[model samples]
Target: MRILHKQQHLPPLDGPRLEPHPFRAAGMPPDKSNGAPLVPVNRREHGLEARRTDMAADQRGEGAAVNTEHKDGDRQPPHGAHDAFDFRQLGKEDFEQFEALLRYAFQVSSSEMARIGWSDREMKLSKKPIFEASHVMGWFYKGRLASQVVIYPMEVNVQGEICKMGGITGVATYPEYTGRGLIHSLLAKSLEYMRDQQQIISYLCPYSIPLYRKHGWEIVSDKMTFAIKDTQLPARHPVEGQIERVDIESEDLHKVYKYFALQEHGALIRGALEWEEYWRWDSDDVMAAVYYSVDRKPLGYVIYYIENEVFSIKEMVYLNQEAKYGIWNYISAHFSMITKVEGANYTGEAMAFQLEDSEIDETIQPYGMARIVDVQRFMEFYPFQFSDPRLTLDFEVKDPIAPWNNGIFHVSWQDGEAVCEQVATCHSGHRIALDIQTLTTMLMGYKRPTYLYNNDRIDMDYHLLKTLEALIPPDKPYFSDYF
Candidate 1:
């Protein structure tokens, strides 16, 4: 059996145990196959040319907030009348009701709550800060909460450029209100809000991929979970660094993370709340260890915990090979107490190639999805790389969900930047065509334009398609933090 170790170009929540990893190691001997094999985009088929005509007149309402009127008297609709749902942001006073709705929607049982060490009081308290920090929106029908979604203000490193992103979470709808399009309305409203805030992109962990695809979200990242026996752990490689346990709240950790995020595409530019959420485990069981050089400069850190002879690594980040080796050495030191080590790797790199024992149990799972909220706004900030300096392209985007992204776009690279504008007229023959979802995956580096074109997701002339490939640099979006 031959093993293939593929190197790819470039958070944290216990809510589902999805975490991000570092970039894969480079310069490994390339596999001498016939050539690079074509891979299919992992998404359900949808009509790319279907434009939602109903949303055309509403394209200009991006900055307008949803009308949420408060009515007095008994808040119940009359018979045979449609429910007038008001969409509005939730406040601290609505936390109790919000918690109850979430609990009921997510089916949180008493036994499961106890197993996760969650008490009603603690859960409510812990969620207060999130509610305050997040843009929590809800739909009320007859003055009762029907559905809700939370949008978190976040920054993501997109091919070395820090772009604003809206992290979507806590999506729930009451059973009585199911199939009424309440969640869809809330999502559309959130996208409009994100556009107003200059958030070029939106990301979410989908409960159903096909369901989210209808709204324009596509898979952007994947995670590999590894379960390795103690005997399979790699031997300690020598490095000029010493490992020391550090406080979880140390400033050095954030500094290292900032440096890493800046250099690595697809990583989150974490804020204080994100960092706090990343370390939201029991401090008594979790431990933080840092690797530093002889000069005492921190280069890497690992957060891990041990329970019942099983060592679980929540996250491990390194700046250099030496730091990586040093962190592994620190983990190796605990071989006497741990029977196995299990953790998630977001880099999509093969770890068995580096291990002493080649046969370790690993599973690769698709992790998160992303969507382009405003294509015109996103292109204005896109860090396009061009070798020729002066290049131009015309393309037609088909966005049924967000009408603002539809129509012909003229892109030109000049004066060290790329400028994108909607053109009133363009030669039809010269225009390349693609839908919003396909464009989202291509820009995020999850798929290439050529791949999309070959797979029938994009339509473009041959020579112009090659040029399109050159203008967009490859990126691997690494999103670890769950909302």
Candidate 2:
């Protein structure tokens, strides 16, 4: 096939993975085909939103240390109750208790919790021991673990800027404590702790999107799923390459990934420590495959396995067209045993457009979300290049998740570089006001300020929308790893 460009030595772990878990699937609206539905905003007179209430109350009963003091009024805790609950970071000693809390809170089994860790045993975990204590925090009521959340520090690449992020997970609360707002209390404290630990951004796989949204998190990225029809495969590239199997324990793949992460935005830095944590899972269901130049230089790798007549492509990465085709040819050559190739696909290019047939079922949905905890710091560190001079745009950021982020920012640039300053008003200049969620959406390329304005998610004039769009750099931000 014709080559657009010949790039070699691509990294591993650059591609996407298999179908997400059912719980993950549940997060997406029922109509994934239509993007997010336009649900009505609650009227003040409509009383309370039941869904939010149920979700907020979901973590109540377990020995959670929920702060219930009134902001104004008597010094007593809410509901005339003041009981003692223990709070501490979980460890090996509390694995069973932690598992029990998760199962009871979420209706998941202890084994399922382990499986979520990519483990088989009930108490065994796949994470690094260094994070074991702080990653898992629990609330104990009367010596019983009631509520817990795992917070792990992650190094993520955001638009070429490597950043320290806190990934929140394993959120569980006992059912008996419903309506006590314990989870909210836990979340508030946990976020405070994250800030103290120098985590500039936080990520999570939310159980309830609305619940998290109430806490100021927004949907930023999405996972795209595709069914690769046999006929849709592209013609093999002209360059010759060889395919080989290698042990996951080898560092060859990790080295290639390191090179790949730097060239791409939104990739995770899988340092030596994190790499070990990633491969502890069983690859038994998947094949161990890699592609290299005929001269023996590694260029690509694939982790996949076939089961139930489906050749599931868990994850694959190729540095160039040759490596991509070489690896695909290996899988297709085994077509006798494979009926279909389905997986997450991202090559910084459109795969369907490259396919022999464009008409196929390819589903793309948002996967992750982020909010600018510190707008000025976020913009100062942001790498933006403007081709025009005299470009300045002001933004009114409404970050419900954190008070520090809610305000106006005057962003300006000179000599193609950019900076931001907090301002009281735009002073008749271009202006845009959007909630943090819409801002995240705009940042991720899912929606633009104009679209958000049209949908009333953002308030902006036509000129302001143009200015806003211009201020946002052109490149689409993507995350290379799932939390």
Candidate 3:
């Protein structure tokens, strides 16, 4: 990897040439100040002594001035000189500083907190679980946290294969420190850490699509919201299974989701951390209903609540056609109790086409993005569809963040098996070209090879394009979880 010094003369890799988007928070400074209430640290990973020993080296060089590539254009440095700061992984001890940066960057107002039932007491109690579950790192100036990013060690089902994934969230920076390349350094270090830990893929919900695109992330999934009137609700479909309402933390709900996630591609396997995030903002009025077979086996569930004459569904998962009909049968029973039903679909397909009444209103928007952390490891585990004669292809990958992924990847498939390797140069004619983001989304089956080439996101010859289309399966990812 190349050092992150200013103006390093590294040759640019081959790929599409789009002008870089300036990294800025946009608009006026946040209304809140950097002073946040102190957070109580609990469940510390290491004792105070061991933590200090591990962080001592990172904190030793606080007084030295360091300059890296400013992702945006050159702006005048603060105080007529570059800021002297330290970069290190955050632990439980740094909770106060980390919380401050998040509040300042996101501008969490008192009114917003009250609406969501957030109080200072609850906020303080939330610190322990977050620190225990996430990997946090930040840039500090004079011992004060200025910028931060959090990575959740998680797993997701990718085309029936359980892949170790790094889920990135809570990224923030102070407005004054925007153009100093602080985020660039943090992102580079984050990618390197994910590679070493064997997290082959990474995903994030982007606040700015263009900003993350420059850093090697592309859209991989979408969220669809649909509304159906009481008259339009699916006509009750009879089934042997029956719906049973249960507690929000029912074990039956967990069992149903576990089976569904395992069988469904691109679904999140919820653990304790994911469950916490799932119900974090909901009120006590929310409840869950699970579909049980006549044989007493749980098959599907829906977490929902009725409010303001509207039946709102947070999530609904089903294992088979019986479960799907049984769950909807429960919702149809509520037709006399509510005016309409509103819910979201994470599967990249339209619900209108499936519903008996195809006139319901629906809208779709991009939800999450992903990037390949280690190209070699990702291709090795990837399940590419293979047929007759052997297929060989070589293409250059241009990754802006991780240098190890910025070389030519040579791949071949034969005898119902596929293998890949990265080399300094392509052995065959450069038949295709892609960036890390495009490759990730393409292989994940979110976007097909032909769509990418037609959209000018990939450069491929006529023959190579057809081969990729056949080699890749057609299954759009079904990701609905947020962080």
Q: C-alpha displacement of 64 in model 2, angstroms?
A: 13
What TM-score would each prediction reach against the true structure? 0.81, 0.75, 0.82
Residues 327-407 of candidate 3 have per-residue lDDT tens digits of 999998997899999998998889998888899999999998999899988876776665433356786777766889988
lDDT of 3 at 38: 27
Give the winner by lDDT: 3
Question: 31 in model 3: Cα distance from truth in Å?
Answer: 61
lDDT of 2 by residue, 393-470 (tens): 677776543666778988776555556788887863657666666666676455655666666676654434444554
lDDT of 1 by residue, 12-131 (tens): 211111123343322222123412332444433433343333234333221111111111111123343335777789887888878888777666677766765878787777777777
**Of the pair 1 and 2, which is ahead by TM-score?**
1
What C-alpha root-mean-square deviation, in Å, does candidate 1 show against the real structure? 9.7
Give Cα distance to truth, residue 149, candidate 2, Å.
2.1
Candidate 2 displacement at residue 242 in angstroms: 1.6
